[model samples]
Target: MGAGMGMASDQQWLQLALTGLMVALLPLSYAWVKGRRDRYRQLVWLTLFLTFDLILFGGFTRLTDSGLGCPDWPGCYGTANPFLAHANIHAAEALMPSGPVTWAKAWIEMIHRYLAMMVGVLIIALMGLAWFKRRELRQSPWPATALFILVCVQGAFGAWTVTLKLQPVIVTLHLLLGLTLLGSLAWLAARSQPAASHDAAANRLSPWIALGIVLLAVQIALGGWVSTNYAVLACTDFPLCNGQLIPTMDFRHGFTLWRALGKTASGALLSHDALVAIHWTHRVFAVVVIAYLSWLGLRARRSLTLTRPALILLALIALQFASGLSNILLQWPLPIAVAHNGGAAALLVTLVFMLTRSGPDTNQKV
Candidate 1:
């Protein structure tokens, strides 16, 4: 019996190793494509695209109650692939047909894990390339190393997201960290190429642009908090909470980041007022962010270099605002909610790219 058990463990290990390798094919293909074109610059762009997809799919996984579908990290139910967990998932589904741990949910969760591992592999390859081509590249190995560290930290948060039962703080931090990674990657990609030499003139609204970026980031954080806490529907009204301009709110509990997922510090279930507070705060802050970003975009439209990005920013801002309102008026429809999240990420990427290009090519002088 002991020998049989040992053999089974060995087989399981082999299966997981194989799955990890199989998931690496996409990045490997990307590397091959980059090698053929000698366009390492475009590789960064491709990675950015994949990162955005990962973020969206991650939202899908969370929204679908698939976060705990597999109920394990780096593997599904002690196996590397969902096939191995088929029986376990099937059994769970049989027992609780309408509950969270269905086979479909497990598959979704495992697929997400696989995609995440692929992104990690891609980042690893990127760092290696950065180091190999450090002489030719303007950016140093330090940023790549920092990115690697960020991904690792993000992975830890991902693990805690499950282990802690999707505690609001951990999950929200995970989202913020992912966005940070995207922004950093965008900055690196912008720095990798020789800046366009024709337009060396400084953006006159650099200070305002910087301020807009900062404010947008803060609003994203608050939005993440609101989503993680499941406060989207806390306030059903458009301009007010419960038909009042200033409805009753528990800002203390709403802003308390250290509490449990659905409970206050004293361990009681959090009040509806707290949820109202969280949601309303995000709603009110949106007005400030939207106004500033719109103004920034309009200000930037004067410069040819920033005109396209500014317009894109303005369009996305409008789309996000509409989608956000639709969520309240339409009862949080999944499609609109997902689009809203994607729009926020898209806006961030656009802003980052614009900011990176808005400045002069200082490295050319170096």
Candidate 2:
């Protein structure tokens, strides 16, 4: 069996850790040199920037069908990298030329892991600095500590994404956790550099902002479900699906959470109707999300303190709408699909950043 069919050994885990540490060095060095006033804050922002990139690259990995490129967790076929696992990868590729395992895909998958591990290492450094410099930093270490725990949980789901054979639920959760990590990091970065503002008018919108976050999260989850299940092309037509307003759908089977990929709860091959259901649900729910977010953006744009972020929010929402339509009309082109995912992340970060600045109880000073 190639690396895809075998399990990662103990030694391989050590090699992966070392590889992650090596990848982390550059970013760590940058934060150290540039962080004169607040190294912790610099690292936090750097980590956030890299985390966003990781999420985009992750989108590439998935869209390219490279999730199973290694077919094993933490390492490529029980080796540290694709180069070391050539024999196994070659064997698998030879067996099935067009299968999930291939040289290019193996590289893509391993690179994703490498980037994820790099992010993990940065988070660890962040938590360490948070604890050691809490007094000087004037920030709670607990948030960093919580971020640390969340990343571990995310790593676990990532392993499951591979080990469980790209099961839809596991993969979707992995995507969601990654975005959640990004949003959390944005919150930290905002806290690190506070903008002194107490706009009661803007602050009044905090509750609605909170609601927007919740709605966006649900939309993201729905989108993740569509992507993980490979249902993006189920209804290729844009405003209407399959040239019909309400096509036949298998909602129960489509939304069955615990089933394996491309299969129903009882292991039957998933029907086209089920895929339609998944895709259609995401498409319909998007109207509500888009409308609500656009309204929120317009509402927030009136406030001087929030105008910039509000503009960013509206711009990203437009990008999302355009990219999302292109995904369907363009037949799920890789670049547009990836941009759609990134747009969602950007929107979340924008909303969270705004929320952090505007607290509901704060009164306007100006």
TM-score of every candidate relative to the true structure? 0.91, 0.96
Error of 2 at 361 (Å): 7.1
Q: Residues 1-366, candidate 2, lDDT per residue (tens digit)? A: 556444447578778999999999999999999997789989999999999999999999999999999998788877899999999999999999999999999999999999999999999999999999888776579999999999999999999999999999999999999999999999888877755466877888898999999999999999999999999999989788999999999999999999999999999999999999999999999999999999999999988778999999999999999999999899999999999999999999999988877775333211
Question: Which residue runs of candidate 1 sit more than 4 Å off their true CA positions?
Answer: 1-18, 34-37, 198-202, 362-366
Ten-residue segment with the worst summed lDDT in candidate 1? 195-204
Clashes of each: 0, 1
lDDT (10s digit) by residue, model 1, range 208-305: 77788799888988988888888999988777678999989999988898888889988999999999999988899999999999988887887777
Candidate 2: stretches off by over 4 Å: 1-8, 360-366
lDDT of each: 0.81, 0.92
